[model samples]
Target: MKILVAGATGKTGIRLVKRLAAGGHTPVALVRKSSDTSSLPDQTQLRVGDLADLPAGVCDGCDVVIFAAGSGGDTGADMTDKIDRDGAMALIDQAAESGVARFVMLSSVGADDPDSKSDLAHYLQAKHDADEYLKASGLTYAIVRPVSLTDDDGTGDVILGRDVDPHAKAARGDVARVLADAVSSDDWGGKTRLMQTA
Candidate 1:
């Protein structure tokens, strides 16, 4: 399968690309011209563009799309809305336009409610709006909302669903693995799951 990974050079995104590669799938890294992609594999196919305005046919021939991009902590709220919300919606639109088979989004644990008072309320709201757009976009989709992230290696034991412990944290690798698994599997489709380490 040829999978396009938006923000494929970011922390968790890089891990997702690796996991997809390990699973015998071709992971296309969607990167910007200024992005330092040294971490990506040498043979990883590159699509040079920003999520905000991807060129036509960027997702052509791709089987799945994973949106793992985020405006970094160094950025402000506007960037969050631009990239996380608007950019994500644009990707969902492109996925539908390109006729991709599946779309998986790497959302956050608190993205279920736009009005929720999560610490990163704005970010969560943007994600919530994007997730809703995906759900109604007439495509098979999976929204994997992981809890606070950590640098620990994946344990491969995750607790998933709405009633999960909100205080838990998931390793970046673990979240990446789950997002990759969700891409090719139908079990996670049409569902929004909050995943955390058990």
Candidate 2:
């Protein structure tokens, strides 16, 4: 399988790419011209394109599309909407049109509802909107909403369900493994799971 990863250069995304490669699947890293690709594996495939301005055929020949991109904390809310909401929706649309087999979304835990009281309300709203869009896009999809992310090594064990602890934290490597599993297996299809390290 050839999987297209939208945030392949980021912490968790990089881990996902490596996981896919080790599993004997081709991972296509979607990156902008300005992105630093030094962290990616030497033989990893690259597709130059920006989420803010996606190019045509970005999803072509891809079996699955994983949206792991984020606008980052340094940027303002506007950029969050641009990349997380609008950008993700655009990619979902393209993936659906391109006959991609599945779309696995990397969403946050609070995205089920954007709380005005939370500092991350806007960001959560963006993810909520994107998640909704993917659900309605007529594509086989998996939405993994993980709690706070950490840099710890993966334990290969996770707690997944709707009632997971809200304050729990997930290791980036574990999240990457779950996303990779979703791409290679049907067990995660049409499911929306909240994840945390067990």
Candidate 3:
């Protein structure tokens, strides 16, 4: 399988790229020019571009497109919508245009609740919008709404299902591994699965 990984420089993206390549699948590293991808495996292909500026043919011959991009820590709703919601939508458009087969999104747990009173509600709303768009796009998609991310060691075990617990959280590595599994699974096709710790 040929996979395109957006946000390839992120903590989770790096792990996803290495594992995909190690599994003998072709991995495309989609990153902004300013991001550091020096740690990515040598076999991984590099594509320098942001989701908003994804080049024509960026998704060429790709089987799966993993969306891991975001405007990190931004409180502004407009920025959240632009980079998270609109950016994800843009990638889906390009993927469809390029005939990509499946799309997987690394979203957050509370994203399904647009009216949540959390401080990050705007960010969650952006992800919610993006997830909805992907679900309605008629493309094979799996949206993984992971809980609070921790840098702690991974448990290797994850709770994978729809309707996550309100107080759930998981290690970042665990979340990424689940995402990799979701992308490679036939079972998750066209399904929105949430992830949480045991």
Candidate 4:
């Protein structure tokens, strides 16, 4: 399957690309003109475009899409709305329009219930909105929502549910592995999962 990755330069996104390729699937890295490709795998297929306005046929002929893009904490809510929410929605729309079969989202843990005590409420709200949109978009979908991300090496073991501990944390590598699986299989489709290290 041709998997189009939106956040190809991100920590998990890079890993997802590698994971997909290693699993014998073609991964298309959607990158911008100024994106840093230093960490990307060699000879990666590139689709140059911004999330704000993707080019025509950006998702054409692709089998599935994984939206792992986000605006960092340094940015404001507006950027989050654009990248996390609007940009993700754009991909969902384009994927469906272009005949893509499945859509998977790399969402946050608390998107189902944003933590009011943290500064991530807006971001989570955006994720929740996008997740809801995908659920209603009539596309085979899965929302891989992972809790606070860590730099620890993956254990490939995780707890998945909405009732998980709020403080649960997951390694980006593990999350990437799950995302790769979610894209390639439908065992967890029609479900929005919250994942964390077991």
Show how many residue pairs clash in every candidate, following the order shown.
0, 0, 0, 0
Tell me how far the alpha carbon of residue 176 in candidate 2 is from the true structure, in angstroms, after superposition. Answer: 0.3
Sort order, TM-score high to low = 2, 1, 4, 3
What lDDT score belongs to each candidate, Candidate 1 first? 0.89, 0.94, 0.83, 0.87
In TM-score terms, candidate 2 sits at 0.98
**Residues 49-166, candidate 3, lDDT per residue (tens digit)?**
7766667778888999999877888447777777899989989888888887889999987777766777887888889989999988888888988878776548888888755575
TM-score of each: 0.96, 0.98, 0.93, 0.94
Candidate 3 pairs with clashing backbones: none
Clashing pairs in 4: none
Candidate 2 local distance difference test against the native: 0.94
lDDT of 3 at 18: 81
Off by over 4 Å in 3: 162-164
After superposition, the stretches of candidate 2 with alpha carbons farther than 4 Å from their true spots are none
lDDT of 2 by residue, 26-52 (tens): 899999999999988776899999999
Tens digits of per-residue lDDT, candidate 1, 42-128, equal 668999888777778888889999999998877788899889999999999998999999999999887887555556888889999
Worst 10 residues of 3 by lDDT: 161-170
Highest-TM-score candidate: 2
Winner on lDDT between 3 and 4 is 4
Residue 69 miss distance in model 4 (angstroms): 0.6
